[model samples]
Target chain A: MTVARAVTCPSCGGSIEIRAAGYTVTLACRHCGSVLDVAHEDVRLITAYKRASANFAIELGSRGTLLDIEWEAIGALERRSPGAIWQEYLLFNPYAGYRWLVLADGEWQFGTLLLDRPEGSLSSVKWRGQTYTLDDSSEIETTIVLGEFYWRVARGDSVQCKTFARGSSYLSSEASGTEVTWTQLVPIDRRDVEGPFVVRQRYKPRPDLRAIREGYSTAPGMDENDLPMMFLVALGALFIIGILQNLLSGPSQCVSNRFDVVVGAADTTHKIGTIDVKRPWQFVTIKADTDKFDNRWVDLDYSLVDRRTQQSIDAYGIVEYYAGTDSDGPWTEGSHHGETLFARVPRGSYDVYVDAGSHGWPSDPRPDTLDPKNPWSAPSTVSVWLAACTGGYSWGMFWTFAVLLFGVPCLILWWRHQD
Target chain B: MSKRLILFSLWSLFLIAISGIATWYAWSPFADDERPTSSAFRGPTHK
Candidate 1:
């Protein structure tokens, strides 16, 4: 039953509907009160409703008055301040993974919204009640962030719904439970959890997590309990350290202005004369960067300009997950398997950068390949698939299945003892 | 003494003209720059 779209009303074209739960009062135009602009030019005025709840709203003015409320609205709570109470949320299961309600304890309905300054962080939501009906250009009050904790909803000693959050607002989820508690950082048996899921049918929440400012969050801190045996011992120690990181690394591909590492979830964002590498040297252009294909990045930066002595360098290309060669030639050291940058670097044609750093590097994107460089590399292990070229590359042919499974049994015992 | 100082100067000019019209009706129109509009809603994103 999701149908409510018809925005119009630039001034009085009059159409209005855009619901995610809003509208009950404060909109007079029996002919003209002119207070409209309900937003819907291209969206983004707060409208995330997968299941919906937190049912409550009261932003009336211009003579506010309307009553159907008989009495006791939750053991008597008729608050009169806190910006006058007019915000309550929850839009469908909120990503419905499961964590709907069980925070027991009666009459919830809390309030406190004040932030002229003082934004360390805060968000608390729970809403339900948007059948329809919202006029006068919508967008009454928008600001949302709700991870979880709401029990269905349907209270009315005369409609009274509002729940928790007053000082710095709260609700977060990075779950882990059993002991760790300081509001947990992770320990619920090493949580990386993603289950109890649900997507279109909506409702995907695993809740039981929090981080109001959490030292800015880099996001990772779990020991290991057995997430598929820690992903098969981290994918067999990254394929035996990617075979000595494929005989010494370099040239998975490099070029930077260091925009955090070329957007950071991994690396690789290239194009260096289409690279054929003949004596211009520094080749291996694109690989490494795989937050499961691509999960949005924030690093790697570069930008050169030898363009006949236009003379430029730009700087800050520190790529390292193991990152080795950025072109000083024949890549070596650590062989390059994950991240490496800012070493000698001087081939040419630059301007490759990434941002969102300081606390947002490749940090933890679940074995996504942040330090590497090819972005994904595998044209027969193209010489240590890059942190920026570590060197020693051999792939003129193709091998490494333990040399065709033990070199055909030692060549039939040396050709049956030399015939 | 002098017709009680002209009836205490007409009751101090009628209480200073009713305290200058209640301080010009509380600083004319609730200044805080007319305040009102505190939007807060965000659900459904990708644009």
Candidate 2:
């Protein structure tokens, strides 16, 4: 059971109610804003202030139910830091002792006295099983005090406070000379406390440590692992499907014809031969071979003209081979011959034309005394073979499209993860 | 339904749709073979 006692403020002679009765040690005159030390029988005036009282969202004497306990606001203290100010409302319950409701930057947090001493350094502390990081450490001074309090709190009383935070909970240690107190605070929603009290205004609370961590982890952005994993899965599936597609396709039937053409000494162009395509859909592969002793490259251009419609399609091929032995090992680059594939050709009678050109490094200087047998170092006789394969499926184009579809997201995820 | 269950279902549906689209594009019937192979005369040692 608790009883309220009425006392007169010595400075202003104004009536003041001490709700905590014997437990109350300080009272501020609501009429003159004077801090009074009520611990002794004769109330002593500690400080006098002329500043106007600031308005609060939760007024003194407001009753509210929090955490399944009934509490009444008995004292209000405004504390100031470097550039910020916050209010701490002392809430009392007959059976629950005292708790604190802190309002800072439109955010509310419920706090209770801590009995167990936490162990760790100033930067980090270990409590129970959780680790907390030091968030702030500073000296805070009380700028104003109103209503009643259990301690002799003056307007200019200062204390050294250190706060450590982990997720949504915070642990604060306050020291005055040799005495120290610890409090554990957890962020609370404003609606939870406003239910039983008449709140004039409500504001959104600032994000706690837990909320900030969740935002960083679960924000609406692509996950670094998810995109790459999806891409790999999609690529694997595509690779398997491509293999199956090729295996299921009809067997390729090829029709090959060879041609030998001799061009005039000065001319590089000549007519090869005529071909009769038998399938509706076929791939045409043209191969060229040239005889050369030293390193040399031969380029050939071929044109397929439709006999009846006079329509034509042009294609080209190249043959080059170079081999040398160095101290390291044997090295070879270009092949002696190369082939090209022209896909999806319609059946028609076609006339083929070939143009060949050769270029290479000049042969090593021949002995001046040796008689020259051949004037040209490159061979003139060119062997060409043309083959058409029907029922062939395309794997290059499909793989390109598949890689692009999956590779883009993978790259984006990689870039984000780097950041 | 619970929010978590609904979210899971939606995610599953999205993945299925993406995979389906990828499969369709990969196995397109109209695609032609344009890839080239090495010369028949060139041995694997040359590569």
The lDDT per prediction is 0.27, 0.65
Per-residue lDDT of candidate 1, residues A22-56 (tens digit):
44222322222234434434322232221122322
Worst 10 residues of 1 chain A by lDDT: A181-190
Per-model TM-score versus the true fold = 0.17, 0.35
Models, CA RMSD each: 35.5, 23.9
Candidate 2 whole-model C-alpha lDDT, 0 to 1: 0.65
- Residue-wise lDDT of candidate 2 within A1-419, one digit each (tens)? 66898877754456788888889888887866778888777777777522322345677788999999999998778898876899888999999999999988877899998898889997999988789899999999887676687877756678999999998899999999999999999998888877775555543455799986776576445343355455555566566545644543334555555554332222266666666666554445565555543455555666667899998767666676667767879887676666655655667777766566554433322323233586544434445554544344555545654665566555555555453
DockQ score of each predicted structure, in the order shown: 0.00, 0.06
